[model samples]
Target: MRVGKKLFPYPVLNNSKNNSGFGDSNYQLMITITQNENYFIIEKAYVEVENQDIERMLADGRAKAIMVVECSATVFREKYEIGIEPKDISIPIGNLNDKVEISSFIYANQDIEHFNSNDFLEDFADFDFSIEKYDILAVDDGYTTKVVFDEDKDKKMSSIFSVIKSNNKDLNVMTVSSENKQIVIEMPSQYFDYHDNMKHNDNFQNIFFAIIAIPALTQCLQEIKECFSDVYSMDINEVMNDKTWFVSIANRYQAVFGTELTSDEFIDCNTYEVAQKLLNCGSTKAIEDFYNLLWNGRSDSDDE
Candidate 1:
């Protein structure tokens, strides 16, 4: 499989002087795009303000500023249509000059199941096969990258495994532990081989391609973990402590992302550390933030 595109380097903005009546301060924003199959994911969008700017903004021990990142996409057809504009997703910047990274993805209608399975298939069933691709536009730092994915096929758990196995014949497949759970395959040898080759050749493009493909299998593994956890009345943490349980988690991660974890990568790490690292790499911050924002109150503060 060909790696799609190389992301451009981040553009650094240095706003130091008052131009056209704005403030006179030195601030920098670096924005970069990271692509996956269906999403134009934002790898890093960080803003840095000078200490002087922070000091100037801080008044009465409180300095509140909102940093917004808005995203939009376009769907092309006989009649071109623009997708809904994403909310003014804002993050609060306190009185600190430290770089704050904001990460998100621009998802197309095809990213959703209803659109992919029904709407798109019905609308463009007869069009030229090549022209049926949809584009997802991600706007960051006044630059946009159009991410394209084919709407003809749904990228299910089975399809992903088929592709991987077809590409690498040495893959040793293992079934997920839970019945009724989605298929989570393991290819420890193949994973190691791919990583070694990437390292040897120093192919960052292939490395990123592997990174993007991982989330697909990870989703399947997550379902299996949840099912197993519920059936056994054990937390993921407890399950991960045991070799079998750790293998299960690792298999799930590998299935989705096409990367196998070394024993050092998972077995050595504590439960919380492993979970945190997984959350960070998997782009599951929205789930964490929702819980923190909505349910965490006075009792939550006490627990913290």
Candidate 2:
């Protein structure tokens, strides 16, 4: 989220020069990233330019906005094209363990002779000059952001877990595990393939989460209860403090119930109630979506 002034060698749009009549308000760059397990870091990037001259240049291919990303941890660096239309980008998440630095700039797409802009400084505003290709015209402040691979309590279920095939023949449906913060749902190979194929459907997503997360959360709460059966003697922080998964589930319990997870109310609650609270009664939504899918057949078109 870096937004500030940057120094450039050439006379470009910036906040420094007096009478430039151009500043950050005239140009802006925005970038957002989403982590997809260990596969790729997806980026949605775009730039905003208020100046009509710059907009015309971009529209006619005289100028281009570019996003420059660098990750020291992974030793990865790459440049991407960006503009008014949002750009979807993906970079392989290979050993990407630390902060990623991102910077953006608008560059001359080709040589421009007699470049003149009403937004330019007084001296340059009326003068026409030759600008070489690849010359920087505008720059955005640089910043750093991190990508997390571990499943903390703050992350969503999608980020916290992945589905994989189970080698065990006796296992029927699915089982959950939160190992090394890479939570996984393991099922028999056949069921695993089915789950993978159908999990992307919005309706199936709600149903799958209900079936897997509820039971997993219930079992997790039971472990906490067994380990600290005496609520009075329980120090919530001390119980499974070393296990991130345990701490995450405990935090979720408190989040849902609005009380310490080791409190008497939590201890007295039954498995069903605990599941309901943990999921915030997610099953209700599942049922609603299920009925919609069955009756509506997933069509958004109105019958004219």
Candidate 3:
């Protein structure tokens, strides 16, 4: 049927006996927009009936009651229509919460030339439109992931401590306590052996240490392998075999030292080479033997 405007009426009941024999009844129409978008819109409108006047009208032989609805859309490119039916409208009286709800659907002719025209542009130029709810989904696969590396300064400094301790047993490395989320290393005398080591080898080892602190180590390793194929010739399987490679290295250091260092305490790439050399030569024992070397007693004959 061609869309046309029509009033859907409801009957009222009469309870009061008056000289005029008419009931004092009242009705109210309430309209609300629930959801709307570019293609289609849905709205809810209601009618309310109340009071004795409305009841008296229904008691009389009046078979119909009519309600007038008025609506307009800002966008002229889309033709909006309204539908009304007795089943679609309701009349509830007495209860403040009682309501008759009407549903409306506003659709556009997609094949029309003015489907998205600018006919209403000037009128609602500054109006802001918003939707209450929506759903979006990606139907196909293929997505990109990103990796970012922001160095943790505290971890870097902890690594430096482990590196220094691995080299010298007599050197005391002082660390300052901080309330903020930062690591501060303090030396009683800035002339500590560790500082001397850093001063001499900072250029080469800093880059190595930074790599170990990469946040996404797996991706970082892959990218490094691709870029430096010749330098990093180990296959991914061999590199990832913790039991055969990493554990063996850790065992070697522990065997020489008589004490095992925790994973976090173990020196990182920056000091790995130097630490290996020290462990190989028993530098830790040599540092402890300095007093014995200095205080070795003269021969008995020379004392005589």
Candidate 4:
């Protein structure tokens, strides 16, 4: 199935401008969202695990590893949190099946729970694995495009990079590994921080959707629909319209003045008047700030 809700991109590395090469702290915490059936699994689980340690685990039969998952809500803000599961589940503790795809990039594949212990390690070839998606937002960095997936694939996706880096010359992205099944993206880390500036609200579902899932995500979805619609079937249009792909701009028109509301309540209204009335009740200033944040990627701007 397609990714259900808006995904909080995995391994949000907050880079310090002081160091060109991000230190150990930057790589320690990896966050991600994966769609499991009806709900989205928000995974903020990571550990500074060593390779040899991971190898040792494989030798044992447990086939399980430690992980820290804060199963919080991403898109459905007022709805649910991980559905009956604890919000802050401790590390070395996550759904084993879910961690298989992402562990390669983080713990270097040691966290993966192979079905067949004997045959699993033997079949650990890189390219042999099936398709996976990744998004990387390189925060205020220069362009370094190392596809790491395929040489030719890198060349083909050059236009995608061009689309993302169109307006800003200052924020260029280098190589982010996509082989681990993620939609890796790069953006200024301030976007992740709550107190960054025009952040009237702490929630960033809209901003993340706009900035990270742009031409890259939509383009990938388009290609998948065209090529595999007949083979691996899905309702491409329905999922795409899940507000996860909506391009939100901070405009007075879209805002409803004097209302404290959530997105679910907005979506559930019946009549045009109800919807319009709802829109007329929200904080226009917050929307304006969000708008600037999404497009400009600067929370602390002179506009507000």
Candidate of highest TM-score? 2
Top-scoring candidate (lDDT)? 2
* Model 4: per-residue Cα lDDT over 214-275, one tens digit each: 33444443443354335454442233222222112112214544343334333333333332
Better of 2 and 4 by TM-score: 2
Task: Return whichever of 3 and 4 wins on lDDT.
Answer: 4
Return the TM-score for candidate 1, rounded to 2 decimals.
0.21
- Preferred candidate (lDDT higher): 1 or 3: 1
Per-candidate TM-score against the hidden true structure: 0.21, 0.44, 0.16, 0.20
lDDT of 4: 0.30
- Give model 1 RMSD, 1 decimal: 24.7
Which residue segments of model 1 deviate by more than 4 Å? 1-24, 55-61, 65-67, 74-142, 153-304
Off by over 4 Å in 2: 1-6, 14-25, 148-304
lDDT of each: 0.33, 0.65, 0.28, 0.30
- TM-score attained by model 2: 0.44
Predicted candidate 1 versus true structure: per-residue lDDT over 1-304, tens digit per residue? 1012323121111232321111233344345555444444443444444434233322222232222333222212111111122222222221111122232212122322211111112333333221111222122223322232345644432233322222455545532232222233444566645744653332232222234324434444455455554565544443333322343455546764577755334333344434434333322443343355567621111110
On the 0 to 100 scale, the lDDT of residue 120 in model 3 is: 17
